[model samples]
Target: MNIVDIIIKKKNKQELSYDELSFAFNSYLKKNIPDYQMSALLMAITINGMTMKETINLTDVFIKSGEVYKFNKKVCDKHSTGGIGDTVTFIIAPIVAALKIPMAKMSGRGLGYTGGTIDKLESIPGYKVELSKEEFYNQFNKIGLVISSQTDKLVPLDKVIYSLRDITGTTESLPLIASSIMSKKIAAGATYIVIDIKYGTGAFIKTKEEANEFSEMLNKIANHFKRKIRTIITPMDNPLSSCIGNALEVIEAMEVLKGKKSPLKEVSLEVAAHIISMAKDISVKEAKELCEEVLNKKEAYKMFEKWIITQGGDLSKIKVSDKIITLKSSVSGTISSINALNCGKLAVKLGAGRLTKESQIDYGVGIKLLKREGSKVKKGDVLAELYVNDLDIKLTDEDLKLFTIK
Candidate 1:
C-alpha cells in the first residue's frame, strides 16, 4: 500500500481502512513515511476530523507501538490540560495514595504558559523524575503513588505523533487531544480516572464553554470505551492557585498538604477530596474527611516526601530562596486588577518559567505576590517579590502597567 495514497486519501476527507492505518503506522515507525506526508495527513485529520471510531483506532495503533503497564492492583490517576498554578496532581495523588488507593501517574514538562508536573517534582532535591517500567511499577506498588516522567517505552508512538501535531498546528484537535490523554491514562493502568479540564485566560481552551466541551468529549469517549473517567471543568481566569512556577509550587503544595488554607489550598483540597472520593468509591463528604485526616495527620506531606525520596530526589536541601527582591508600590491605592497573563509573562521573563523546551529554569527563581485578588494598598507597600539569582533584577516599568491601582 502506498503511504502517499493514504495521505492524499485522508486529505480528501476519506476514512482510512484498518489495513491502511496499519501500513501507515508501520511506515511512519520504520521511517519510510516522511514527516511532510504525515503533516499533510495530520492537517487533513485536523480539518476533516476523525470519527470516534477513527480516533480510538488511531489510539490503538499507537498503543501497539509500545508497552502498556498492568498493575493487577486497583489503580487510579488524574490529569489536567494544564493551567497557571494548577498543582492538583501533586496534591491529589498523595491523598489517594494515603487512602491506600493506588496511583500510577506520568507527567510532562512545560510547553508554554502552563506548568509541567515533572518540573514541580524536580524542585525537590534529589528527586528522580525518570523511571523505568520496573521502577515505576515497583514504586507504585510500594508507595501507592508513583509520579514520574512518561516512560519512553510507554506509548512511544504517541510521542512521535504528538511532535508531528505540535509542529503541524494540529495540537488543538479535540479527538487527537482526547485520544492522546485517555490513551496515556488507560495505558498507565488507572482503573479510575479523573480529568481536570481548565479554561480561562490561563487555560488553552480560553473559555469555560470550550473547556467544558473538551471535558464532555473526553468523558463520552471514556464511557464509550467502558473506561471509567470523571471529568471536572474548572475556571482558570485567575491563577489556579496563587503560586506559579516549579519550586514555589512545591513549597505551596507543602503548605496545602500541611493543612494550611489559602485560595490554592481551597481549590486543591476541593479537587483532591473529589478525586479521592471517586477513586476510593466513597462519598464526597467522606472523601473530604479523609483528605482532612491526611492533612491533619500530615500523612499527605510525608507521603509526598517519601515519593520524592523514592524517586531519588533529595528533600532536605531543596528550598526556594527566602531572600526575595520585593517590588514595592511606588504609589498605593485601591488595587484594581492583577492581570494573570501578563504576570505569568513577567514571571517567565524573570526566570520563573521557560519560553522554549531547551531553556534552563532556575529552581530558585520564582514570583511571589504579596497581595492577591482584592487588596487595599499604600505607597511603599510591597506588591510582589522576584526570587532570582540576579542581585539587580529589575521589575520592568511595563509589568507595572499591567498592575493597576485605582
Candidate 2:
C-alpha cells in the first residue's frame, strides 16, 4: 500500500494494479510521496515500459484525480502532439462546428518550440482562456463550440506528473505519453477524438515507426474506453503553416478559413474531415466535401467570428509588431526545405514562444514565411519577415539558415 513498494514493483517491470497506481498518484498529489521517488518510478516505467493494462490503469488514475466534465450534447475534440507552426486547431474547430458538430476543446500553453492553441487564442485581446464549469457548459450549449485552457480541477494529476516527466527525461516514454494525452482528452469528455501524431526533425516522434507504434498504443486505449478515435500521422520537417507566432498564426488561420489555399488549409481540412466523419457517422470523403463546401461558402469563417466574439476575443485587437526584418535569399534557386525546428527556435528568440512556463509571450512578435518550400526565388528576394517589438531582437546569419535554398 506504501509508495515505496509500488515504486519497487514498477522498477522490476511488474504490472501495477489500479489501486496501486491510484494510491501512488493520489499520495503524490497529497504531498505524501516526494518527487524524487516519483521520478525514480517514472524512469523505471520509461525504461521498463508498461503493459496496456498498466497504461490504462495509470490513465484511469489520472482521470480519477479530478473531475470529469460532461456535456448535454455529444462533443468532439482533436489533439496534435506538439509541432512547429501547427495551427490546425484554430481552423479545425470552427470548420467542424460550422457543420453543426459540437467541439469542446481544452488546450495547453506553449512550453518549448511547439505552439499551443490556448496561447494562440489568448493573443487576441480579452480572449478568456480559463472558464468555470458553468461557463464552459453554457458556452457549449450556446454556440456548440468551446475552446479553453485546462482548469486545475480537470486532470490535475496529469499536470503534476507531466511537469516531473518533462524534467526527468521520461517525456518520450510511449506508455506515459499515451496515458497523459488520453487522460486529458478522456477527462474532457469528448465522445469522439482525433489525434494528429507528427514525426520528423521538428516533432517528438523522430520516425514513422515510432509514430506508428504510438498510434497503435493510442488506438488500444481508445478502444478500451469505447471512445471513437482517429489518429493522423503527419510529417513535420517543414512548418505546417507559413506563420510561426501567436497573433501571426491566428491571422494565417483566418486566411485559411476565408478560403486561402495553403498547407495549413489542407492539413486542417483533413483533420476536421476525420472528426466530422466520426461524429456524424459519415465517410471521410463525404466529410471532406462538406468541409470544402463550408470553407468555400465562408461558413467556417462566419463560425470563427462568432466563436471568437462569444469567447470575448477581439480580432481587431490582435496586432503583430510593426518592427519587421525581411530575410532575403542570397542565391537564385528554389527552396529545398525550411527547417521546422530552426524556425521554431528563431521564433522563440523573437518572443513568439516561452523559454519557461513563466516566460512572458510577446503576442505581437513572430515570423512570417513569404515563400515556402519548393518556391523559386531570385537573389535578394524576400524569403521571410521577422516581426519584433524589442529593438534588440535581431536576426543573425544562422537564423537565415532555417531556409535551405539551392
Candidate 3:
C-alpha cells in the first residue's frame, strides 16, 4: 500500500486498482504522500496514459472525497471546457430556468487564457458568489436557477491535486483532465451534465480529433458511474462572442438576452437547447425553438435581471473603461480568419485575463470584435476595440496577427 509502489506501477504503464488509486489520493490529502512523489506519478500518467478502469477509479476517488448536494429536481449542470470570450453559462442558466428547468451550477474562476463564469458574474458590483447552502436551495426552488462558487467541502482533494497538476506541467493528460472535470460534476450531484467541448486555437483542446477523444472519454466515464452526460463539440476558430473581458462579457450576455443577435446568441442557444432536451426528454430541435422563444419574448432576459437581483448583483454599478482604442483594418477583403489564441492573449495583455492564479484583473478591460470571421471589411473599417484600464496598452504586430485577411 506504499505510494511509491503505486507511482512505479503507473510509471510503468500498469493499471492501478481502485484501492490503490483511492489510497493514494486519501494518503496525499492526509499528508502521508509527498507532492514530489505525487507529481512524478501525475507526469507518468500524463505520458503513459490510463486505462478506462483506471480513469473511472480515479474519478471515483475524487468524487468520494467530498459532499454531494441534494435537490428536489434533477439538477441540469452545464460546463464548458472553456475558451476565449466564453459567456454561454450566463445566458444558458436563465434561458433554461425560464423554461422551468432546474439549473444549480457551481462555477470556477478564470485562470489562464479562458474566462470563467464566476469571474464574469463577479464583475457586477455587489454580486455575491459565496452563497450559503440555504440560500442556494432557496434560489433554485423559487427561481429554478442558482450559480455559485464550489465550496471547500465539494471535492476538496481536487484542489490539492489540481494545483499539483497546474505547476507540474501535467495538465494536458486526457485521463487527468476528464477525471478532474467529471469528478466535480459528479460530486456536485447533477443528474444531467452538458459538456461544451470547444476546440481550436482559442480553446484548451487544439483539434477536432483531440476534442472528440476527450468527449468520448468523458462519456465513457460518465456511463461507468451511471450518470448521464451529453457533449457539444464546437469550433473555437474564432471567439464564441465579440466580448472577451469580465464586465464586457456580462454586458454581451445581457445584450443577447435582450434579443440582439450575434455569434454568442447562436452558440448559447445551441448549448441551452441540449440542456433542455436532455433534462425535459424533448427533441433538441424543440428545445432550441423553446430557447429562442424564451429569448425572443425577453423572458430569459427578465429572468437574468431577476437572477442578478436575487444574487445581489448590481448591473448599474459595473464599470466600463473610459480609455478606448479602435484598431481598424488596413486593407479590405473578407476576413479570412481571426486567430483565437492570439486574440485571447491580446485580452490578457489588456488586463482582462490573469497571468497567474493570484493576479488581479480589471473587470472593465476587454476586447470587442467589430469585424468577425468572414465579415466584409473595407480599408479603415474598425476591426476591433480595446477597452483598457491603462492608456499605454498598445496593439503590436503580433496583436494584428489575430486578424487575417485574404
Candidate 4:
C-alpha cells in the first residue's frame, strides 16, 4: 500500500490495482506522502503510461480526491486541448445553456499557449468565477447553465498532477491527457460531454491521425463511464478566431452574443449550435436556428451579461479598446499561410498569455487578425492590431515572424 512500492511497480510497467491507486490518493490527501515521491511516481506513470485498468483506477482516484457534485438533471460540457485561438467555449456554453441543456462547466486557468475561460470572464469588471455547491446547484436549477471556476476543493489532486505534467514534458501522451480531462469532467458530474478535438498547426495535436486516436480513446473512456461523449475534429491550422487573447476574445464573443457578422462571430455561433444539437439530439439546423434566435433576438447577449454578473465580472464600462497597435503587412502578396504557434508565441510576448503557469496576463494585450488564409493584402494594410494594457512591452522582429506578407 506504500507509494514507493506502487511507484516501483508502475515504473516497471506493472499494473497497479484499483485499491492500490485509491490508497495512494487517499494517503496523498492525508499528507502522508511527500510531493517528491509522488512526483517520482507521476513521472514513472508518464514514461510507462497507464494501462486501461490503471487509467480507470487513476480516473477513480482523482474523481474521489475532492467533492463531486451530482445533479438529478442531465448536465454536459465541452473541452478542448489548448489551441492557438480557440474561443469556442466562451460562445458555446451560453447557447447550449439557453436551450435548457444543463451546461455545468468547470474551467481552469490558461496554460502554456492557450487562454483560459476564467481569465476571459475576469476581464469583465465584476465577474465571479467561484461558486459554492449550493450556489452552483441553485443556478443550474434556474438557468440550466452554470459556468464556474474549478473550486479549490474539487479534484485538487488532478490540478496538482496536471501542472506537474505540463512542466515535466508529459503533456503529449494521449492516455494522460484524456484521463486528466475526463477526471475533472467526471468529478464535476457531467452526464454527457462533448469533446472538440482539433489538430493542425495551431493545436496541441498537430496531425489528424493523432487527433483521431485521442478522440477515439476519449470516446471509449466516456462509454466506459456510461456517459454519452461526442467528438468533432476541426482544423486549427489558422487561429480559430480573429481574436486570440482574453479581453479581445471576450470582445469577439460579445459580437457573437450581439449577432455581429464576422468569421470569429460565425464560427463561435457554429460551434455553439453543434454542442447544443449534440447534447439535445436535435438536428444541427434546428439547433443553429434556436441559437441564432438567442443571438439575433439579443437573448444570447443578455445571457452573457448575466453570466458575467453571475461570475462576479463587471459588465458596465467594459469596452475593448479598438485604438490598437497595428502590426502591418511588410509587402503585398498572398498570405499563403499563418503559423498558429508563432502567433500564440507573439500573443504571450504581447502579454496575452503566460509561459509559466504562474505568470500573469494582460486581458487587453492580444491581436485581432483582419486577414485569414487565402487572402490577398496590400502593403501597409493593418493585418493585426495589438491591444495592450501596458504601453511598455516592445514588439520586436521575433514577435512579427509568422506575420510575413510575402
The estimated TM-scores of all candidates read 0.87, 0.92, 0.92, 0.89
Residue-level lDDT for 111 in candidate 4: 62
Q: Each model's RMSD to truth, in Å? A: 3.1, 2.3, 2.2, 2.7
lDDT of 2 by residue, 182-230 (tens): 9988999999999999999777777999999999999999998889899
Q: Native-vs-model 3 lDDT?
A: 0.86
Candidate achieving higher lDDT, 3 or 4: 3
The residue-by-residue lDDT of candidate 4 on 284-306, one tens digit each, is 78988998887777777677667
User: Which structure is stronger by TM-score: 1 or 3?
Assistant: 3
The candidates, ranked best first by lDDT, are 2, 3, 4, 1
Which predicted model would earn the best lDDT?
Answer: 2
Candidate 4 Cα misplacement greater than 4 A, ranges = 1-16, 19-48, 319-324, 389-396, 404-406
Provide the clashing-pair count of each candidate structure: 6, 0, 0, 12
Estimate the lDDT of model 4: 0.77
Query: Which residue pairs clash in candidate 2?
Result: none
